[model samples]
Target: MKAFLLLLGCLLATPVLAGPRVELVTSHGTLQLELNEQAAPLTVANFLRYVDDGSYNNSLFHRLIPGFVVQGGGYDSGYSALPSYAPIENESDNGLSNRTGTIAMARTQDPHSATRQFYINLADNLSLDGGRSPGYTVFGRVTAGQDVLTRMARVPTGMNMQLRARDVPDEPITLLEARRLSEQAGGTMTSEPVSKP
Candidate 1:
């Protein structure tokens, strides 16, 4: 009985392995994102670099389209596009959809032009799913802080000369800090082996 209890305690202490976890500390609230490496490996790895390097700190959510998505991870409070590394290949065919709360890479019309910018879907954006169109890669999802995203969607927006773009938030919502959530939870944020489609 003593041996069994010891083994059971050891098993309970073991941590379950999981995908990478990221925490976004925005002015509105903090959001937890779990990147899906199995579905979007390259994109996940690229985004994690920005998180690890503290590039996302002080960044602002530059674009917010009603009933569409809240886009960020690139611009500062001044609405200037931040420098980024080389773009990664589109992995939208990885069976993930641009569903509500799902996070997707933001790119130009060029399918392979996603670098640092990303967006969170506010609705089921089937238009972003792959089929006839070159779909945006869905890499992660908002696991917490949906209220923060919802508040973001309702903020007043307009064209900004700084961004030279429409749908810009009149009052900037800043991402105060970003870090790997695992660091606080005693887990390491490591990229996993991606199974190809």
Candidate 2:
């Protein structure tokens, strides 16, 4: 009976595995992201909601700054707004930094207003970490396709009249699909057809 209790206790003490990986097939190339649910559960869950519901398919990477971030997951290729769930809590204090290759939520001045929009850091943006304010939540990192993100960073950007936003990619970088890969298939590159700008 003591051995049984010990085994049960050991089983309960085991840590849960990290969240599933998501593959973002974009016009530039594919990027595989490994989410860190253990650190930022709410943020990870919020992102997976969009991925699982196919809401992120056919989306546009509207904002691209050369050495900052590539923001998207809110607008479609036609610049139409995509529906979003309720805002999630600020998980910036989860000890994740806004480092290069890290994927973080994009919010407005309101610290807890992050919904569907997200961005990938092109540089180590440590200033974005929570200090005086609730910083952007870094819930995942790019496990594959760093080169793809590099190519995306070099794309020309300018003011987009349709979005009325600056730093818009001159050539639309559409997220053709966003799907979750099985645990065994995570970080493995698959030969899938990618769309072009």
Candidate 3:
């Protein structure tokens, strides 16, 4: 009886591990993302910081390349650049790949320059995997609403005078809100609004 009781206590003490999930409410539609904290802990934490602080709310999908990627989480509805936290270390060596439906960080020429911007792969981009140099860090995958992303990809894009960039959606695709999912309830956790600087 004591052995069985001890086993029960051990089982109860062991914590359940669940990958963090975020629900992105966008003008196109809602997307569910499951992050691999085990593979890319730094990247996942960076993304969750924005989600938890509501910094992603009302952001626009500023870039879209039909056959390549759908990028965002940087500019606001007014086309103004949002403030970002300090850059994070590159975790591209994480086993994750830039496969279709996988979300990865967007960075400058410098490998560790990734901050607030991210992109979702529209196709399998094996060339992005780490080899000669560090690659893009893919921290999560879209668990739902891939069709919405397809729709966003199909939207007409052109050079925006404000952004001075091409591939800007003719009609803005806004991320209405982004919130973390509760591990036990399968419901969203409310985030405090982050004031733009």
Candidate 4:
């Protein structure tokens, strides 16, 4: 009986393997994202780098469009932005698709310009997946607090008449904090109030 008990204890003491976790604290509420590193290793590593380096802290969710995506993580509250390093290679070839509740990188016209900015898809964006240009690279998915995203999606937005851009919300939706949740380590990122022009 004593030997059996010792064997059981040893089995119980073994640590279970865990995946990467990302925590997002927004004005609405906090969301915990679990990254599928197996599916997106390079994408996850790049995102974690920004988190650890404080690149995302004090950034604003500058562009929001219901049923489209909520994009942020590179611009300050003032809409002034930091210049990110040369773009990472396009990983759109990854098997992941841009489905609802999935998080993906946002880039300029250049397919590889996706650096620090990211967006959560409110709907399945099939078109974003490599038609002519490379599609957005999906890295993770929301494991919790999706209602907060639903609320953010429903928020009213208007066209930026000056810029002729659509889907700019009247009120600012801030990303209050970001942190890693799983055994894998990362840091939090946030935004400040925007200054007037």
Candidate 5:
């Protein structure tokens, strides 16, 4: 009976074991990012940890460079930066590319230094993909809502780039909310609202 129960548990837990998909519902619309657990398990898992922990609630898109990228997941609603944790090891060699619409972790000039923040590629940032240095790890792709990203790319930007000394939006975009997407039998994961943060 114990063995049978163990097997049943495995069967019941298989779906969650497969990891999760996520959605970023910005002011423009919703974006579906399919996390690649097999390729970047640690990174994907860490991202999900942030989601479940409510770390990204009401975080403003502190940095926005039109035609470059839309960045957030760190600062709060009032533009005050949050206390960041230690840097994450670089996983740029995880076989994902910095192609347009792909989602990746944002880090400092140092490679292997990713943390809570992430960015969506507005253009093909081949330079950051290790040809010259350690590339940015591409942990997921935008499965939906590219139109919303395009709209974000068009928002006027200025010189308030986060952490960097260049290319930031004068008026930052706020990430209204973020949450884990529900599982589908055979369809892409869809998100349910956790809270408005």
Candidate 6:
């Protein structure tokens, strides 16, 4: 009885901690990103909210630049902007750099305008870091399927008929699903789209 009671006490006193890892089930391939909640708490929370809400399913990676960034998390496969939550505060001051494979929040000219859009840095983008003003928030980095992101970057891009936007992938790179690692089907997070026009 004493040993059992001691074990219970130890269990009660042990802290429970969990970090977030989101699987990006995409057309080009799968990508897994590990968020830095301690460094960018608000940003991480906002991102997880969208992940938890299924807001990102079937979203398009609307912007693609081979050596720059691949942006998404705002549009559906039809190229329409998904309804976004109210903007959140910029966590750019978190000291994370916009380096290769890092993921950052997308915002307008206002530093605190991040809502539901994000981008993956394909190269060291020092210019996007905190300068005279708060830069884009770096909340996470691609932990797996970096090559999948690279493949997405190489996709042909031009003016998109749906968005009438330039630099849009001629062939849409769709995010088919997003989920926590523990909840995802076991497979390579990176695989070419089963089918794409």
Backbone clashes in each candidate structure, one number apiece? 0, 0, 0, 4, 5, 2
Candidate ranking (lDDT, best to worst): 3, 2, 1, 6, 4, 5
Q: TM-scores of all models?
A: 0.84, 0.85, 0.85, 0.78, 0.79, 0.82
Query: Which portions of model 4 miss their true places by more than 4 Å?
Result: 1-18, 131-133, 160-164, 183-197
lDDT of 4 by residue, 46-127 (tens): 8877766666766777778888899888767776676676678778878888999999999888888888889999899988
> Against the unseen true structure, what C-alpha lDDT does each candidate score?
0.87, 0.90, 0.91, 0.77, 0.77, 0.86
Encode model 2's per-residue lDDT on 1-197: one tens digit a residue. 99999999999999666566889999999999989999999999899888878888899999999899999999988899999899999999999999999999999999999999999999999999998778999999998899999999989999999899999999999999998776445444443332222
- Model 2 clash count equals 0
Q: What is the C-alpha RMSD of each candidate to the true structure, in Å?
A: 6.8, 6.0, 4.4, 6.8, 7.1, 7.5
- C-alpha RMSD (angstroms) for model 6: 7.5
Worst 10 contiguous positions by lDDT, candidate 2? 188-197
- Checking candidate 6 for backbone clashes, the offending pairs are 30-189, 30-190
Off by over 4 Å in 3: 1-16, 185-197
lDDT by residue (1-197, candidate 1, tens digit) is 99999999999999865678888889889888989998899999999888877788899888889899998989877777788989999999999999999999999999999999999999999988889767999998988899998888889999998668899889898988877764444454433322222
lDDT of 3: 0.91
Off by over 4 Å in 6: 1-18, 183-197
User: Relative to the unseen true structure, what is the C-alpha lDDT of residue 102 in candidate 4, on a scale of 0 to 100?
Assistant: 93
Lowest-sum lDDT 10-residue window in model 1: 188-197
lDDT of candidate 5 at residue 185, scale 0 to 100: 75
Q: Is candidate 2 or candidate 5 better by TM-score?
A: 2
